[model samples]
Structure formats: C-alpha cells, structure tokens
Target: MQKTFKLLLVILTYFSASSCDDLFEYHPNQIRLDSDERNLTATNLERLQKQQPGDTLRLIVMGDTQRFYDDAVDFVKSANSRFQDIDFVIHQGDISDFGMTQEHKWVQDILKDLKWPYLTVVGNHDLLANGSKVYQQMYGPLNYSFTYGHTKFVMVDTNGREYSFNGKVPDINWLAKELAPQQGEVWQQAIVVSHVPPYDADFDRKLEASYHHALAQSNMVSLSLFGHIHNWNTDYLYDNKILYHGTTTVKNRGFTYLKVWEGGYDIRRIAY
Candidate 1:
C-alpha cells in the first residue's frame, strides 16, 4: 500500500508540473515560439497555393479576436463544421488585446484548429509598443497580397492612429501598385482587407482621398474589408460601386462569408 501511494503521488506531481509549463509563460512580451509557429501567414499561404484551384473563391473574413479565446474556439468549430467548402480564412487583426505576444499566441493556438488555411492583417492594437515586432515575427509582412482562383487579396496595414496620423499608415503608393494588374497576374478582381476602413477616424485623414483614388484606378477592386470597431457596418463609403465591410469582433460571435467570381461577389454574415 505504501509503495502504491508513493507511485500515485509521483504520477500526479509529474502531470501537474507538465501541465503548468504552458500556463505560466516566461514573459508576456516574450518572443518565444516553436519553428512551426513562426511566419504563420506564409505557412497558411503555402498550404492555400497547393490546394486544387476552383472557379469561385469562397472564404471567411473576420477579425478583432483580441482576448476572446472561447469565442475564437467556437468560431473555428462552427466554421469547420458548417463551411466545409470554404477555401481559406481571414483574420482582420487585433490578435492580442494588450499587444502581448502571449495573447497573439493564445489566439493563434485557437485559430490553428481551423480546417482551412488562414491569414491575418495588422490592427491598431497590434501596432502598440513592441506588438508590431511580435506580430511580424509570428505572421509575415504587414502589407502583402496573395492570389487564388479569380481574385487577388490585398492584405494591407491601415492602422493610422497607431502611427499618430502620420499620413503614411495606409501606404497609398503600395496600395495603388498592389491593386493594379501585373503583366502576368491572372486575377480578375481585387479585394482589400485591413484593420481600419478609410472612413474611420483611426485612418489617416490626409491619405483618404489618395487611398480611394488607388482603388478607383484599379477598376478591378470588388470590395474592401475591415475590422477594428468591434461592430458590423457596411455601405458604399465614397462610390456607390465600392462596398466596404466592417466585421465585428469574434467576441461578438459572428463572421462574414465571401464568395467571388470573375466580375461579381457575394457577402454573407454568419453567427455561431
């Protein structure tokens, strides 16, 4: 009886120690991460590129997960179970509430369960002190683009307030170049995704005109997606033809489903 009791206690102690290893992190801002956790944007993009091509591009565009761990998990579950046909997922930013690397990791831990490849843009909160570095380390560049099917996704950083309204957060020049058709680029349309919409106060006022100008010049921009206010809003901001979609946070328990083809697209909201 004495030997059995000692063995049981040893087993319990070992399990407890192992469990708490991930519970208490070395630091909130620590950059510690496994090789598999780094450059998640690139990782998922590679996965997306390898999949069989389809005519219509179907994807989920959502954001502002922040500290909502439970909701994020449920969102993934609902997405996987209900939208098995989706090609990929888009997280609009604010992966961390306090801009802590740990918070980003926690959200990533939950988002990893998603059945489809996912990508993320940066938000104002994600641009906080040292947060940008952490975000870049975990995800790839702040402003980037990818093409799948008939659409080109322009994921850019538009968190202007985080840069003190410097009139450069949106990078209008880059946006123009990204939106325009490249010589061999076969995409029929462009979709812009960012954390802040151009009409928002958080976006740089000086660059708003230039930003819209870039989209208009492309002649192929289908829609603009944003997530920062934690509330869903949509309308044709400047031009009746260009629709801007603002998605609520994951804590609100909802997301947007986007389907696109050569000349047109559809947007739907799903609550789980």
Candidate 2:
C-alpha cells in the first residue's frame, strides 16, 4: 500500500508540471517568446536587404491565418514548392484568431519553416484582449517601412474601427511623410500595406476621403496592398488614382502574387 501511494503521487506531480508548461499564463497581457521569434519584422527585413533585390521585387502576399493551423501548414508547403522563384513573403494579418500570444507563437512556428523571409501587418482579430500588446512584442511596431529594390514598402495599421474610430488611425500625416522622399531614403515608388482597406466599412469612414487624397497627393504612390476582405481583389479606386490589391485569407488556401518593378507592377492570384 505504501509503495503504491508513492507511485501515484509521482504520476500526479509529473502531469501537473506538464500541464503548467503547456497552458500556464501569468497574465492576460503577458508576452512569452523565444529570441528568434521576437522582432521578426526587423529580422526578416535584414535578410531581405542582404539578398539585394533587383529592379523588380517578387512577393507572395497572404493573410488571415487566424485559427487555421492546418491550412497554414499547407500554405508553407505550397509556398515552398516554388521556393527559389520567390523573393520574400508578406502576411497581411490575423496571425491569431483569438488574439492570444500562444496562438501567435504557433503561427510563427509554422511560418518559420518557410524558405524565404516574411513580414506581417496587424489584423482586427489580433486586437482582441491583449493581442495588440502581444503582437507588438512579437513583431515590432504596428506601422513600419522598409526600402527594397526600387520601391519603399510602407506598412500601416488601418484597423480604425477597432480603435473606435479614434480619428488617428491610418495616420494620414505619417503616411504623407513616409510617402515623400527623405535625405537618406532611396526609392522611386511607394507601396502601402495594411490589413483593412479604406473602402471597407470597418475602416474609418471619416478618413476615407483624406486617405484617398493622401495616396493621390503622392503621385509616385500607386499600389496599396490589403488582406482583411478574405477574397483576392484588385481595383483602380480613388477615382482611378491608386491601384489596390486585396488578398485572400489562409483558410481559403489562396494568395496573391505580386511582381513590382521601377515603373509598373503585375498581380496574379494563387489558389494553393
């Protein structure tokens, strides 16, 4: 009887430890990550710079990976099947469906297997609970830019409704500044990326006019990329001044292929 009791106690202790390791959360806003997982946007940008993109930049744009683990795995495989032909990947957002850090980590684990580097924008679903905080810790700023090849890719956060239309989202002032040429920056064209497009109702309706005007003001700015729509779409909106490329969600097993050069660009949808 004594020996049996000791053995049972040992088994219970082991299981308790395992459970804690798997599901323990010290705080709802806690962010736990490995070194390689943190600041992924910055890391991937460094890798891209080293590759030295030519006059044309080829990319695989996809998003809305939230709660779609199986599909996400298949996406990496499909994306890798044509690995060498691609330069880098752009994940439009919704890395976590529930806006949990663990979910973000799981998604990153899958994405890390890709042959090329990748970047992400923050999605609306990612704003749930402490998701926004976790996203910043894991992926750097909500808005950032990287100059590559002959174009400057400006990533912005346009999920204004999530902020209750705070009147500051999609920051036209910042967009205008980033779109313009600076002393140290080098790029002939500007490409904006975000999770939500301004035409969508979820976007700040009040800023739609100003948003379109800002893009138009920068005559060099023509193409903007988005992913919240869950459908592959491209349009010449803003009175045919700017071209928008909206990509599909991962659950649909689809993405958009973009090849942009100095003067013009091309777009194609891929159903993987």
Candidate maximizing TM-score:
2
The TM-score of predicted model 1 comes to: 0.91
Against the hidden reference, what TM-scores do the models get?
Answer: 0.91, 0.93
* Candidate 1 stretches greater than 4 Å from native: 1-24
* Model 1 C-alpha lDDT per residue in residues 1-272, reported as the tens digit of each score: 99999999998898787855376678777787777789999999999999976888888988898888888988989898898788999999988888888788788888888988999999888878788888889998989999888788999999888989988889998999888887987888899998988988989999888888888788988688999989899889898878898988999999999888888888898898
Give lDDT: candidate 2, residue 226: 95
Cα lDDT of model 2 by residue, 143-246, tens digit:
89888878988999999998999999989999898888988767899999999999999899999889888888988788999999888778987677789889
Error of 1 at 214 (Å): 0.7
Cα lDDT, model 2, residue 115: 91
Model 2: clashing residue pairs? none
lDDT measured at residue 111 in model 2 versus the true structure, 0 to 100? 94
Task: Give residue 211's error in model 1 in angstroms.
Answer: 0.7
